[model samples]
Target: MSRVLIIESSARQQDSVSRQLTQRFISQWKAAHPADTITVRDLAVNPVPHLDANLLGGWMKPQEQRNTQELEALARSNQLTDEVLAADVLVLAAPMYNFAIPSTLKAWLDHVLRAGVTFKYTETGPQGLLIGKRAIVLTARGGIYAGSASDHQEPYLRQVMGFIGIHDVTFIHAEGLNMGRDFHDKGLNQAIARLAEVA
Candidate 1:
């Protein structure tokens, strides 16, 4: 059975467009593939620690050399990375926070995107180790910025996912969320419709 790992990064527990989209996607996906296994990791509720000296030491130092604090930090990263490594499908639910992804989400990314684990340097250049994986990103934005330079979410996510060997990616954006009712409804509706099709 296919394993689907969903990373939830929305800060708001209620009335979050990104979370709504993920719920819809989960329902549709489960209905479509009943045997598939789905796992959800909520960053807002249980946030992962950002990259720090302890984590760095944990990664760099050998197991015998790492202290208690360093070992704790390393364990967290290992757990997060292992979850991603086990999943065949990755789903990210992101809500725009000051024109970028939430800090919690960024921290989670820092934990999982490890050198010599997820990616490695080759004779020519860096190469991603994880292969045969696909990703779906559900983004909620305050304004319309799909292909525009102001839209930092999609492009940054694309680059990071590609770096980890997830080339088959699809982005469904719910933009104009803070705009007027017409724009909000339209954007959410369009996104939900697209999610239905994609799932």
Candidate 2:
């Protein structure tokens, strides 16, 4: 059975297009692979702590040298990193905020991308450790920005995912969410249709 790890970052619990996409994905994925294990980490409900001195110390210092707080931070990072490492498929649900991803999601990424755990410095260049994993990103945007330079979300996510050895990534964007009724209907319907095809 494949392991699927889903990270949900949308702040809106009631009406979030990203969350809708994830719900659909979960249903379809479960139907297709009945035995696959699915794990979800909802950042909106339980935000991961941002980078701090304690976490930094935990990452840099050895176990014998780490303090209590540092050890706790290290343990948290280990758990998050291990989830990513164990997953066969990774799904990130992001709702665009200020032309970028949510801060909560960014914090989660910071924990997951470790120095020697998820990536390593090599003689030639930095090498990723979490290889042979597939990632699917579901994004909800207020305006259309896919394939444009204004869309900072996809490029940033692609770089980070590739850095951790998840090179095969697919993005499904639901754009023009805040636009007028016509645009909203069209964009949402299109995204849902594509979701069905892709899921």
Candidate 3:
């Protein structure tokens, strides 16, 4: 059976547009693929630690040379990576914080995008190791940013996902979420419609 890994990064537990979209996507996906296994990792509730010196030491140092703290740090990071490696599909739900993804989501990315594990150095250039996977990103924004230079979320995520060999990526954005009622409703409905078509 196919495995779907969902990473949720919205901080709000209630009335979160990203969360709502994710719930809809999950429901539709389950209806369409009853045999697929879905796993959700809520970064806001149980946030992963940011990349730090201990994680760096854990990655760089040999097992015999690494301290207990470093080994523990590495173990946690490896678990995240292993989950991604086992998944056939990835779903990321992110709400616009500043101009980019949430810090918690970034931390999870740092854990999974490992060298020689998810990617490796090649004779010509760097190469991604993970292949045959697809990603769908559900984003909620306060204002319209899609196709604009100020839209940092989509481009950065595209680059990062591409770096890790996830090229079949689709982004569904619910923009103008904090705008007037008309704009909010329109944006959310449009996003949900698109998600229905895709999922």
Candidate 4:
């Protein structure tokens, strides 16, 4: 059975554009793959704590030599990574906050992007351990940035996902949300129509 994991990081629980688009995409995806199982992790509602010095130090320790604290840290990291590894598809609802992803989402990334787990260092450079997984990122922005030269969100997101071996990544942008009602509606409509082709 195919498993899809959704990571939602919008602070606006029900009213977020990113979240809404993600839901639409998932609905379409489910319609296409009726037997797939979907799992959701809402980061804004249940935020993952930022990694601290203790947690960082704990991560550096060998798993067998870990103390109780280190063990707990390892367990948490393992749980996050395990979820990603087990998923056949990933959907991320990312809203642009200060031209980047929300901190809650970044915290989740910190937990899951563990060395020797999601990726590893080799003589040939760092290699991603996870493979054969596809990702769809639904992003919302205040202003119009679909094809602008200043839009950094899409490229940054692509680079980050690529770094973790998620090369088959697709982006759906709900941009110009804060511009005006007409622009917002236009942009959203375009995105929704495009979803039919991709999802």
Candidate 5:
């Protein structure tokens, strides 16, 4: 059976549009693929630690020379990396914050996107290690910013996913959530319809 890893990064547990989209995606996905296993990692609930000196040292230092703090940091990174490595599909719920993705989500990405693990240097350029994996990004934005220069979320996410060999990625954006009731409803409905088609 396929394994699906979902990353939830919305700060608000209640009244979260990104969470709503994820719920719908989960329901639809389960209906379509009943045997597939799904795992959800809620960053807001238990946020991963941001990259620090210990983490960097843990990654760079030799195992025998590593200290306790570094070892613990490495262990945590290993767990997060292993989860992503084992998953067949990756789903990310990224609620836009100041025109970018949540810091928690970014921290999780930092843990998994490791050199010589998720990617490696090649003769031509850097190459991604994780292959045959797909990703789906569900984003909620305050203003309309899709395909525009101000839409930093999509482009950055696209590049990051591609860096890890997840080239087959689809983004469903729910924009204008804070721009009046009409825009909110329209954007949400459009995203839902797109998700329905995708899921």
Candidate 6:
């Protein structure tokens, strides 16, 4: 059976547009693929701790030489990485915070993108280890940023996902969410329609 991971980073539990869109997408996706197993990681509700000096040092150390403290620090990273590696599909609900991704989602990415696990530096340069997984990024932006030259969130998300070897990444953006009530409803409807097509 296919394993799908849903990572939600919105701090707003019920009112988050990103979360709404992701839920719609997942519902449709399940309808399309009933046998797929779904796993959810709600980052806002259960936030992962940021990488500190101890965690960094532990990650850099060779596994065979790691001490008890280092091993403990590495455990979180290992679990996060293993989840990503085992997934056949990933759905990320990312709401733009100050024109960037939320801290909760960023923390999860830090734990998963280990040097020797998710990625590594080779003679050719850096290479991503995880492969053959498809990702759908459901993003909610306050204003209209799509197709704009100053939109950093979309490109940043794409770049980071690509770096982790998830090149087949699709973005479903629900933009103009904070513009006005009418605009927000319209944008959400459009996003839902798009989700129907893709999911």
lDDT of the candidates, in the order given: 0.95, 0.93, 0.95, 0.84, 0.96, 0.86
Off by over 4 Å in 6: 62-69
Per-residue accuracy of model 3 over 112-181 as CA lDDT, tens digit each: 9999999998999888787899999999999999999998999999999999899999999999988999
Clashes (backbone N, CA, C under 3 Å), per candidate, total 0, 0, 0, 0, 0, 0
**Which candidate leads the pack in lDDT?**
5
In candidate 1, list every pair of residues with a backbone clash.
Answer: none
Model 2 Cα lDDT, one tens digit per residue, 115-180: 888998999998988889999999999999999989999999999999989899999899998998
Mind giving the per-residue lDDT tens digits that candidate 4 earns over 61-118? 6667777877777677778889999998988888989888899998998898878888
Q: Clashing pairs in model 4?
A: none
Better of 1 and 2 by TM-score: 1
lDDT of 1 by residue, 150-172 (tens): 88888999999999889999999
Error of 3 at 171 (Å): 0.3
Off by over 4 Å in 5: none
For each candidate, what TM-score against the reference?
A: 0.99, 0.97, 0.99, 0.92, 0.98, 0.93
Q: List ranges where model 4 is wrong by over 4 Å.
A: 63-67, 147-149
Which one wins by lDDT: 2 or 4? 2
Better of 2 and 4 by TM-score: 2
Tens-digit lDDT track for model 5 on 80-152? 9999999999999999999999999999999999999999999999899988999999999999999899989
Which ranges in model 2 have alpha carbons more than 4 Å from their true place?
none
